[model samples]
Target: MSVANSVSEISPRPSIEGIVEITRADMDRVNALILSMAGSNVELIPQIAEHLISSGGKRLRPMLTLASARAFDYSGEGHVKLAASVEFLHTATLLHDDVVDESALRRGRTTARMIWGNQASVLVGDYLLGQAFKMMVEVGSMRALAILSNASAVIAEGEVWQLSAAKKMSTEESDYMAVIEAKTAALFAAAAEVGPVIAEAGEPAIAAMRRYGMALGLAFQLVDDVLDYGGSADALGKNVGDDFREGKITLPVILAHRHADAAEQQFWREAMEGGSNDDEALARAMELMARHGALDETKHRARAFGAQALEALDALADTPVRSALADVVDFCIDRIN
Candidate 1:
């Protein structure tokens, strides 16, 4: 049965904690599964992967996988493999991302590149990608393989696109959205949708889960952008003006640029495209964003996506698992970092 049909037959109001509670056991099992999959294979690669994996970040992606599976009453062991594969893919991407961005910190600690050096980090990332594909093959599900592989491809494309487009004033909202979706939303959609695929969920349920993932992922990225503009360094695990220093044009900057007067626009254009990383120029850009209410507007959009994510969960029946998914959507918006 479709999740929409199931939900229509249940009570309209359900508690968020209740839904998630039903999946607690499943979540734990998946966590163990992921640890086993990532456990010490060789000395250096495992050490590097563990350095960042053990850092204090919520395992939200794998949690989504497990929860989505339980929401549909999936009882097969393949979900465990799928969940582990998702975490491996995510961690692998993070390793490469730190290198590409030359970031020194993540989750408030030294990044993989800083700890292991760039070459080690890159190779370990490639190792994790290999592990991810190997796990997918073990799962032996063509649908799951297709979803994850496509997501991996999209992530690579997004990274390349971002590298080429950063600091370019010609970037539009459409272009930014495309980049964020490919980089961030693609994996989220895969994580959320894979559960139903394992369970052989009906087409409508699959579609609903896909929408839920997309909206949730977009909300997550939007909030990340907002935090870049407004969050404290301690809260965000990086300098407050890092994006501006790097000349990355996130949503707040896009809005601020659009709202700026001729002189203000010129200032942004020069700071972004001129390869200037001066502190004063970054401060001026931030000031412009605040003066125009661009930051606040971006926050509103993030909240809207969060709300849409919850609405998509309405397709799921009045189950404890569904409510948990809703809570997660809410949590994404309120995340401090």
Candidate 2:
């Protein structure tokens, strides 16, 4: 079925309103810090940075940090700094990712790289990374520093690993999982962990938040992969078929290729190698994925991870913030429904 038909058929989607309402106060401080740190003496830096930062996408990663802290009932300003640092880490990644992916659109607008050039985008990303570290240091927690700093390294390594695997048919499901866990979930895990760490919560609480963030990150990414094929630009905040157009192998590509016949396999090979990417080829790619049940299977995998996320939260006491965090999982998965 088409994206419109799919949307009409599914149940109503979950929203992040619960978390949003609760985290709004902390997020205000986080947003202000982000804007202030994003500015620089170099005129071009803030120009490109603000453009990417102000894009329509939800700043979910940092919000998770604030929510995690609030759930622990921590009353300190350190969580605010850590939360801003998490946003910087995340924003930096997007700046670098758009360059690496050669993406034209992000959050429904032209990418910074598209407007400013790759060099500027990469430098601004580096600047943001510096700011992220600065804020992490200001928090004055060695453990939080270690978590976010280590996550930054892992994310870089994951990017290189993904580049190496791009368009290579040998890339397996397990390999794809590793990439997402590092590139996507590492920051999520770090963002959540640092919150409870700042709260000086027990080891068990910290571990639970880390686990929840990892699962949510994985599920969120899987849904994004599915959205690249089965959703629209308007809904997705990025161009549809971008993964296909860029030859980045995601879960849908892996599943479809796994079960593909010889001709179908050949199609993927050529398409992934940048040989086929017209409108017709994109339609063909979607048709093949639909025929092979890759999209649905991907969604199933996402829901499984979402279940894990909720399970992780069970370790924490039942609170409004915890419940709101659980709702975030449903919201992430239900995006393309």
- Model 2: CA > 4 A from native: 1-12
Q: After superposition, which runs of candidate 1 have C-alpha atoms over 4 Å from their true positions?
A: 1-23
Kindly list the per-residue Cα lDDT of model 1 for residues 189-283, writing each as its tens digit.
Answer: 99999988888888888888888998999998988888876787665667777778788888898999888899987898888888665887877
- Please report the candidate that would top TM-score against the real structure: 2
User: Whole-model Cα lDDT per candidate?
Assistant: 0.83, 0.91
lDDT tens readout by residue for model 2, 1-337: 8999999998766999999999998899889999999999999999998999999778898999999988898999999999899999988899999999999999999999999999999999999999999988998999999999999999999999999999887799999999999999999889888889989888999999999999999998998899899888987778998888888999999999999999999999989875587789989988999999999999999999999999999888888998899999988987856
Instruction: Give each model's clash number.
Output: 2, 0
Best by lDDT: 2
Candidate 1, backbone clash total: 2
